[model samples]
Target: MSLGKGNFQFFGGSKTLYELKQNMATIGQQLQKTEGELSQKAIDPTASMEDIQAAQKSRDDLKMRFDLIKEQHDQMEAEQKAKFAAKDNIQNIADPNEQVMKAKAELIKATIRQQPIPADVKQILGDRNNTGGEKLLPTTMSDQLLMEPLVKNPLRDISTFTNLMNLEVPKIAFQLDDDDFIADTETAKEMEVTGDVVKFGRNKFKVFAPVSETVLRGTNVNLVQSVERALESGLAAKEKKVAFTKSPKSDEEHMSFYQTGSTAIKVVEGANIYEAIVNALADLHEDYRENARIVMNYADYTKVVSFLNNGNSTYFAAPPETVWGKTVKFIDAATDPIVGDFSYSHFNYDLDVLFERDKNVRTGIEDFVLTAYVDHQIKLKSAFRIAKVIDTP
Candidate 1:
């Protein structure tokens, strides 16, 4: 009833596989022992008919159990082999970008379906397990989403990002010295350069987008891309509000340029928006003016365009992309024009976005909550100058 013992190998080397192999071996041994007992009973004339029938039944049951165990072991081995083969094929792709794209697509599919991401896909994307059932976007996808706002989020484009991953206490260090070099003799005393560090405060931002369960479960819809775009728009709007309109109190951490208490230069009497911007730029320190970017509302930019194109000319020309060789960033939510070196504005963010689903069983409506950690500060308040246009009474 038992097959001969042969060499056996299993993929993945998992504990479950090892235990299955042991169970198979133990069942095979029991079947062999039962067969031997049944044969002896059949040959012995002293053995009763009832005893012989019981031995045969015992042998048949053992054989059935062994067959079931063998079937399970074979199935597990085949699954592991197929997984490894697919991984090998992915690794053998010539183009690295193609490999990443393929892996990213797999991750996206898994995320949309609310299934666990494959182990190989996680390895390729350097992703961690979703222990809390919150799906984490792949690193590549997170980076793409973060940068996507740059098209409409001028603040994000101009601000500098500091990687704070694995940091217990994130901080930004800034040099306080005005001059690092001085004209001195070889034996002149060396001056000490000073600097300061600002500890980052924890700030969390969440964006929620309502998605239909049908869309999430459907194969025809591109749920990942759609959710990504929706989240991107939502985040962009929140960023504009945070960076331009939020006025933090003294006890609160300053997260917006408007809250930094930087020097505000009021527009001179009878000056146009363009002149006001120029005046604001002039007010900034010479050291910061070189890298200064002009940030204003889109409506204000239209006014500047009108001012520039007011005169009748032979050729129709659009406003230059830059003002006085400085890049101009137009945001819709800005109330005042700002001229400053935005590099001094520091932002820190988590490398991955956590996605969670909120389902309403009563209404059959589902929404996804996308969460990310972020902190922002203006390292040097003096590096910025705001143009405050006072109303004429």
Candidate 2:
């Protein structure tokens, strides 16, 4: 099957896409070995027709299996394409309000599936039709807003190091040093006892959204969408800020991997993109090279893709999911490619979310105010293995 940047395929669901490629390589090698054995049989003067036929059959069987694997890979690619097209259709809808509402509904569905729905929320949503008259106490027509499940957030789903924590206390302490290690033997040397202790305190992030009273009580599904948009905007910005913010000079905020002097950094020279990527990988410490990842913006990644598509290089094979045999992630914030041991970096959360709503006696505006609060911390365990390439002409 023809493979390109857009139509890349992978199989073996639980295994990473790269691992499946390794399987294909193994199959190809076995086919080659079997074919070689058959060639030797053909050259033997005492070889019988039965021996040659059996060897040929074995090689043919391996080829068939390889073909089947390729077919499965192609099928997966087609399915992925269809999914992307469908998602695009939803996103490009003509009506802006309808588009946002649909997206918000999806998010609501996802959240409801995972957590218990509050009685008040259920009452507000279930009473959409307003079946009861003014005399009916609980079945008032004023609460007609419909609700949907939550949409799944891709960042939270795909993040390797992000985690959730449930803590009654606001702060957690981490020991930077282990319980002391073994030293020189024989003539006892003085034991080294000095180390640093860092405290990870919860930082609160708050955001507010104001909605008119008419929109809040309206039966229109768009109302939920408006609220969702405001909340999502805040949350998305917070996530990006936490992940990509440059490390600070002091302990004012959490240090990110991109900050200068925060970790190992390298400068890339020359015009060849492929070689520059290899050099970035090389800059990683030998200990973390095996697990290192290359992160770059979509534009830079597209450049690499263009190079591979040309098929001019003889140095190494380029696979769809990897470069230099390591996983590659396309991130918009990654202006320059970063080669890092991601396992050493982690995201910690003290609370998932704290949402509050106020209706009466608020600001002068005739709108309800909704506020959301989140607490989290980011910690980089080690910086020795991480490095970013500073591209220069």
The top-ranked prediction according to lDDT is 1
**Local accuracy of candidate 2 as per-residue lDDT tens digits, 1-393:** 333334343434455445656767888899999999999999998999999999999898778767766666567667778888777554556686565444434334323233433334334333332433211211221111101114322234334322234433211133235443322221012112212322344555654555665554554485665665665556556655655666533552453545554232335433565567776666544645666666667777667777766776532355635556877776687666666556544444432233334433465323222232333232232322333344565
Query: Which stretches of candidate 2 lie above 4 Å from their native place?
Result: 1-199, 210-214, 219-222, 247-253, 262-273, 285-287, 311-320, 357-378, 381-393
How many backbone collisions does model 1 have?
Answer: 0
In order of appearance, the predictions have TM-scores of 0.62, 0.44
lDDT of 1 at 249: 38
Candidate 1 residue lDDT tens string, 8-105: 23312344766888988887898999899999999999999999999998888777767866777788889999988876665666787666666655
The number of residue pairs in model 2 that clash at the backbone is 10
lDDT of 1: 0.65
Q: List the residue pairs that clash in candidate 2.
A: 106-150, 106-151, 107-149, 107-150, 107-151, 108-149, 108-150, 109-149, 109-150, 110-150
lDDT values, one for every candidate: 0.65, 0.49
